[model samples]
Target: MNDTVKRKLNIALRINWFCYVGLLLLFVVRNLLLEGGSIQLWVIQTVPLLLVLPGLIKQRYRSYLWLCFILLLYITTSVVGVMMPTRGWEDGVMVALSLILFFSAMMSSRWHRMQ
Candidate 1:
C-alpha cells in the first residue's frame, strides 16, 4: 500500500478499536446501572465481541469481516432501543458507535487486504 493508504488504514483501525472498546464499556456500564449488574447480560453482549479480539489485535482481515457481521446484531438492538419509549442517551450512543464500528471495520478489512 502507498503511504496515504497506509495512513488511512491505520486511522481506520484505530477508530475500529475505539468504537469496539467504547461499545464494550457502554454495555458493561449500562448493564451495571440499568440492569443491576446482570452478569448473564454482560456475557451475552460481550462474549461474541471478545471472541474476535485476537483477530482484531492481529490485524486479520477476516476478523474485521467477522466484526462487521457481529456488529449487525448490536446495530439492530440499538435501533430498537432508540425507538423505545423509555430510551436514554446511551441507546443513541450505542447506535452511533456500532455504525461507526461497522464502517471502520469494513474499511480496515479492505485496506488490510490491499496491503
Candidate 2:
C-alpha cells in the first residue's frame, strides 16, 4: 500500500480504538460516579454527538481542523464553566469538553490525509 493509504488506515484504526473505547469508558465513569440516571447522565450522552459531527460532513477532516474544533469547544466550555455556576447547563458543557478532548485524541493521526 502507498504511504498515504497506510497512514490513513492507521489513523482511522487509532481513532476507533481511542475515541470509541475511551469515550465508552468515560460514559460508564460518569454514570457510576456522578449523579447517575439524572440530567447529568443525559448531558454526558449528548457529548458524543458533537464529537462525531465532523465525520458526517462531506469534507475530509484533517487533524489540525479537528484540533481547532476541539480547542474552540474546549474554550467555550471553559468560559461557560467559569461563568455559569449552575450544574444544569454547565455540567453539560463540561461533558462536552471531555468529549472533545477524548475525540480529538482519538481521531488525531500522525499524518493527516486531507482531500
Candidate 3:
C-alpha cells in the first residue's frame, strides 16, 4: 500500500519476468539447437510458476501458502531421496532452489507489506 511496498513489488515482478523470459529462451535454444520434447515440457511448466509471481509480488496470502506447499514438497522429496539408495545430487539442488524461492517469497512479501 505504501511506496516501499510498491517498489519491492515492482522489483519482484521484474525479477520474476526476467526469470520467465530466460527459461523460455533456454527452451527455445534447446528446441532449435538440440532436439527434445522434455525441454518443451520444462518451458510449459515454467509458465504457471511465472504466473504465480504476480500474486507473490502483490503479497497475496494464497501465494505465500502456495510457496509454503512448494517448499514442503521440495523438502520431502529431498529427504526421501537422501534416504534412498540411489540418491542424486540434483535432488539436493532442488531443495536449495526451493528454499531460495520460499525465502524470497516470504522476504519479498514482508518487505512489500512493511510499506
Task: List model 3 lDDT by residue over 5-81, tens digit each.
Answer: 77776776465445435544544554455544376666564555565667766658567557555556546755786
- Residues 1-115, model 1: lDDT tens digits: 6999899998998899899999989988988767555878888999999999999888899999999999999999999999999988899999999999999999999999998
User: How does model 3 score by TM-score?
Assistant: 0.50
TM-score of each: 0.95, 0.39, 0.50
Model 2 stretches astray by more than 4 angstroms: 1-5, 8-12, 32-37, 48-59, 62-68, 71-115
List the candidate numbers ranked by lDDT, top first. Answer: 1, 3, 2
**Highest lDDT against the true fold, candidate:** 1
Name the 10 consecutive residues with the lowest summed lDDT in model 1: 30-39
Candidate 3 displacement at residue 52 in angstroms: 2.1
- Local distance difference test scores for all models: 0.93, 0.52, 0.58
Question: For residues 1-115, could you state the per-residue lDDT of candidate 2 as single tens digits?
Answer: 4777667656665554454445445555656656645556546654744565566243344543564455455456646755665546445645565555545544543333422
The candidate that wins on TM-score is 1
What is the Å distance of residue 6 in model 3 from its true position? 9.4
Off by over 4 Å in 1: 35-37
Q: Could you tell me the C-alpha RMSD of candidate 1 in Å?
A: 1.1
